[model samples]
Target: MDVALVTSLKDGMNLVRYELVACQDSKRGVLILREFAGAAQSLGAGAILVNPWNITEVSNAIGQALDMEPEKREKRHNHNFLHVTTHTAQEWAETFVRYETILSMKLLLLFLGLLSLINQFCGTSLPLLVASSDIILVY
Candidate 1:
């Protein structure tokens, strides 16, 4: 069904919420989300958080969402729109790779230190030298 109001009980990374917010760039829409939903933490500031089990609460939220002033709706939509546009999946993946690469390099350096001592004692050379510039993250 096509509607301006979007509600969800519980979801893991509710992409529908982002889709709704993205589509509502011209027309401000309302979103009522459950507190336990994964997207709530990110969009709760803009969405109306409610308990789905509470029918009265949910009903009241529906009314509030429908009857909300244009200025308020615009403000809420702006918040969510900004988040959705800036925090994209590619951006998140790139950030994860950057962080993990740094952590892995640190651990590798620690291991290499032990190898250095062994090489000195055994009068042997290790070809396991890695330069920071050698690893380039294109993304």
Candidate 2:
């Protein structure tokens, strides 16, 4: 909820959805998508959680997000912003990279090992090639 999204809200525009970072991808450590991003639930409870594999569920989540109460929306946004300010995917990556042992050759194998899990997380999407150390791929 930064930059344009928050700016839009500040201008009195209600967010229906985010095209780049969909609400579906808002979750982390959400075991369902963990195989893909290996993240936990960092989003607030206000999110409309759903399985991307289930089209019907996705439709339902969209409806839920669209129909959420204003009070609930406020709570969710607060939670999301607080979480973002403190913890981020970049922080997690930095922590991981800071571990001396993690920078060894084994990390490459670990990345490869996560490929299958990631593949399962990304249904029709192509496998993500994680080659750039400087790149921080967020959901």
Candidate 3:
């Protein structure tokens, strides 16, 4: 988890530089966790590190992170911030949507938006397609 990374500087748990985070592949995945772990080790100097499995280890990691010198912590955080900003997309959040749900919602929103647009424009009737594939118009 990036709990420590999410904390603010001087918060004693700098999991990431905090300026940015790519996290494209996954926000929650083992590979993502491991990737974060690797980055924390090299960039944060194990200050924001955690095992996630062992409670004791997590606690110890937190204490170790909090006790690090401020200058060293700042330096490590800068590295994380730099890497996140330079190497990754500024905004790359991926979300899952069901195909059927997405299609239905998009169609509904487009239909509503077009309807509203037409209502705001010329005074005329517009054809509306129905579930039966039949065209219907309103006067």
Provide the TM-score for each candidate, comma-separated.
Answer: 0.74, 0.38, 0.36
Query: Residue-wise lDDT of candidate 3 within 78-118, one digit each (tens)?
Result: 55555566554333322233566788899899789777866
lDDT of each residue in 1-139, candidate 1, tens digit only: 1224445644655588889888875778788887677888888999998887888998898889888888998889899999999899899999999999999999899779866755665654534433455552221
lDDT of 2 by residue, 1-139 (tens): 2211111212122223322134333332111111112122444243445545566765655566566665665566555555555665688888887785667767788778767657676875564555456764432
**What is the lDDT for 76 in model 2?**
62
Displacement of residue 44 (Cα, Å) in model 2 is 5.5
State model 2's lDDT: 0.45
Full-model lDDT for every candidate: 0.77, 0.45, 0.46
Worst 10 residues of 2 by lDDT: 29-38
Backbone clash count, each prediction separately: 0, 5, 2
| Better structure of 1 and 2 per lDDT | 1
Q: Which candidate number maximizes lDDT? A: 1
lDDT of 1 at 136: 29
Candidate 3 versus truth, CA RMSD in Å, comes to 13.0
Residue pairs with backbone overlap in model 1: none
Estimate the overall C-alpha local distance difference test score of candidate 3. Answer: 0.46
Which regions of candidate 2 deviate over 4 angstroms?
Answer: 1-40, 88-139
The C-alpha stretches of model 3 lying farther than 4 A from their native spots are 1-47, 90-139
Give the best candidate by TM-score: 1
